[model samples]
Target: MKRERDHQFECGICGAEDRYLLHNVRHRTPSYRRLCTNCLLKDHRGLFCPFCFSVYEEPLPIDRSMCNKCPSISHKPCIPSNYPHHTPFICPSCSSPNFSFFNPTTNGDSPSGRIIDRDSARALVAAAKIAAVSMTKAAAMAKVEAEKRVKEATYAKKRAREALERLAYLAAKEKEIMEGKGGGSNYNGLYLAPPPPPPPQITGKVEK
Candidate 1:
């Protein structure tokens, strides 16, 4: 949608381009701050109300009319009794010049007065489906990549733990070798300590 009124702004939360909202709309939030639809729905608030930004909560009736000038929709209690049901309807903001923020479609892609051809509508639907499929594929790829990274990290940690255990075993063996000095500590297929002194050196010659 295009803004006609003077001021320009963005959503307080998401920083997406936005406009000054109605008092009722602003009050939907606890802080009465303005936000876009996606930002509001993160809290699971409401549906897509263009004027209120639906932040989504503000309940809107299913019975509604699409505006003639823009893609905005207005439902009961929100719109006037004189709202055209049969003919094209211009949304309140588009109809009124004095509104705090007035936005109507600048591009004539779907002007209410013009009915879209069947082929054009079909093409638009096809494009939307393609986009949705592409998004799903991208999300799947991201999830797979994240899982792979986690697996790799776990493997590295396991290898590190094994190495630490080996070092600890070697450290213990070194102490044992120093104390025993014989027939005790072996490491990596090698006897680390010298043989015991030849049975106290039998200095007095062998017995007859």
Candidate 2:
């Protein structure tokens, strides 16, 4: 079924005409009836309250808007003037006040205008604690795995070092043999002397 078109009031200030552009248009109250979008967002207090066109000349004592859902307090008004007030006072997802301090579901990406409450607040905190502990455990396990890998590498290095030392000792023995030192017998295969040249061939005719 087609939805009915809502009656929209013009911003008495800028005269911008359009339901979507109008600030707080969804919540049609007396004071906001003819106000422009700019003026409405600038309202620091209940200036644009539906009951009263509360444009208090002086800043109202209550500077912040309390979340109807979680009731968490935020520096930025739950209802920003530039954005649409889709879920005004209460959080749509958590159903808590938008002013909640600890919100698991209420990350930076959470949609605007949702409410949160005290019960939900506690739940959010508990969930966060569990997540933190889980992350810590995973990190510890990774460190242990890394240490094991390091130990294996060290063992391999030690074996290589021993093999190199044996090679050096064998080379020293071969050197001693070449220099006519007695150690030649110890390195049988490694220290073979060149064959003596054949006796000068008796090719020349034997002298009579």
TM-score versus the correct structure, for each prediction: 0.34, 0.36
lDDT of 1 at 47: 29
Error of 1 at 98 (Å): 40
* Predictions in order: lDDT: 0.49, 0.45
**Considering only N, C-alpha and C atoms within 3 Å, which residue pairs clash in candidate 1?**
45-57, 46-56, 46-57
- Candidate 1 lDDT over 1-208, as tens digits, reads 3452322466556466644331112332222444443333322212233343322223646676666766556554556456544466666545655532222334456645344344334333333333344356566666897999999999999999999999999889787866666465566756656665676544667778
lDDT of 2 by residue, 70-130 (tens): 4333334434465434455532223422432222234455564334555444433333333
- Model 2, residue 146: distance off in Å is 2.8
Runs off by more than 4 Å, candidate 2: 1-112, 181-192, 200-208
TM-score of 2: 0.36
Look at candidate 1 and tell me the lDDT of residue 171.
Answer: 84
Among the numbered candidates, top lDDT falls to 1
